[model samples]
Target: MSLPPRAHQLHVLACHACGMVLEDALDSTGHGRCPRCTAVLHRRRPNSIARAWALLIAGLLFYIPANVLPVMFTSRLGSGSDNTILQGVIEFWHGGSYGVALVIFIASVVVPCSKFVILGLLLITVQRRSAWARRERARLYRLVELVGYWSMLDVLVVAIVAALVKFQSLSDIEPRSGILFFGMVVILTMLSAMQFDPRLIWDSEDT
Candidate 1:
């Protein structure tokens, strides 16, 4: 009996111990354990570059307007004001909601931007097959994945304020252009993360 020529290609593997699927291709040694569960793993998928590219591009596109447009509108006692994402953060900070402001700053502004930059770096590095700081790159990818959803905090806040502060003539809250852009940013980053193939980092090292 002979194995197929493609059988040696790196592919996603499943762990027999914890039942967790490894995102990267199996080690050439024909035996590798799951990073999460330390269980023996098997090949599952061969490549993930195309999906990752699409996601990163989408995220890059949405990153633009997330910062440019106004995220919320507030009307108080017949006086209305619209604030961009940064302005809202500043308002919260000036109004003594420092903690809330900080959270929003990190989640809405910093995290999304950072995620994009980091993912972009990783993609570029993988494409160039650069092996420097392999561990650091992997760590950065995990961080991006973890913080990706946090960017939606702004959207959540908008929804909450819109629902709770509906005083009509007295006070009213409305979604702004930034909200849409910000939402797209969140969605795009998530898509990027989903599209990204973490296994590539390790594969580059072997090559």
Candidate 2:
């Protein structure tokens, strides 16, 4: 079956800012602006795949240390123990703080791991130009963006709990290097998502 022509092939560009449609030539520089809204119109983001790949790899590198190192230290009386993210979740679960455990598990462990997998899949399929499940892949990319907004939930929970416990005479909580690494993973993954161009999924191919 023959596919219909794409808007780019017709030289029609829509303004992302104001929905203004304009006809322009695609060039090496992708230099042009929407006359109504003055928004830069580009066929694709420059270095989109390259930038996304770099950020994704950096996030993966930090993922290991983020899981292995102690994310927090809890000192009760004169003794203390180092708790990695998983250990903290386990502790909360055993201590009957089920809700807190579930929240932390989802935000800290599940969400980040899912982002790594989903982002990797998108990058791989786009590079391969695989037409399989194009719509599903696009939806996964959107899912990545949506979850990013809550990526910091785990970090914020820790910070809030630490602050609240600071007033106690015998108990105190302190963040560790793992939390910092995890924070970096979150930031890098979010940036990676932003760097990716979703339009690439439907370009130069027919579904």
Candidate 3:
């Protein structure tokens, strides 16, 4: 069976922000401004793979310290304790809040790391002009885009907990440097995914 032609064959590009279709699309450097919303248009994102790799690498670098350092500091009657991400997850598991623990572990650790891996693979394959599994690769890109934002779930939880669990002298919960690093990880990975242009996956003639 013959497959349907892709949008690129028509020499048009869709505006991501406003869904406007511009004909004769050739603004790859993002200099062409969209007439409707004034958003810059790029046929293919400029330096997409490189920018994505940079952000992904930064996210990975931050991931280490974020897991090592304490994300939360707690004090009860002047006695202070620090808890890292894994420590908190384990604590939650031991305390029988399995659902929340699982959610945190997946959202905070698995999602971001998997996103990095997936995006890295996509970039490598696109650069090599691999014709293997073009449709599947495009699906993978959509999956990455969908889940990238969810990595922030743990960060939001931490912020909310810190906000709610405050006490003057009896007990207190405050965010530490680890969560800040983790936040950066989430943000960087999301940005990385956004910077990646899925159109590159099908750039080769065979694809």
* Candidate 3 residue pairs in backbone clash: none
What would the TM-score be for candidate 1 when compared with the true structure?
0.78
lDDT of candidate 1 at residue 108, scale 0 to 100: 83
Which run of 10 residues does model 1 get worst, by summed lDDT? 3-12
The C-alpha stretches of model 3 lying farther than 4 A from their native spots are 25-31
Per lDDT, what order, best first? 3, 2, 1
Winner of 2 and 3 under lDDT? 3
lDDT of 1 by residue, 1-207 (tens): 973433225344456457665555544556666788776665433345567677767777776777787888999999999889899889889999999999989988789879878988998898888888988999999998887898888899899998899898999999988788789878977887866777677765445
Model 2 residue pairs with clashes: none
RMSD of 1: 7.4
lDDT of each: 0.78, 0.86, 0.86
Arrange candidates, best TM-score first: 3, 2, 1
User: Please, what are the lDDT tens digits per residue for candidate 2 over residues 73-187?
Assistant: 8888867889898998898899999998998889898999999999999989999988889899999999999987586876777788778777354888888898899999999
Superposition error at 175 for model 3 (Å): 0.9
Which candidate wins on TM-score?
A: 3
Model 3, span 62-106: residue lDDT tens: 999999999999889989899998998899999999998998888
Q: Candidate 1 — which pairs collide? A: 11-25, 12-44, 12-45, 13-42, 14-42, 52-195
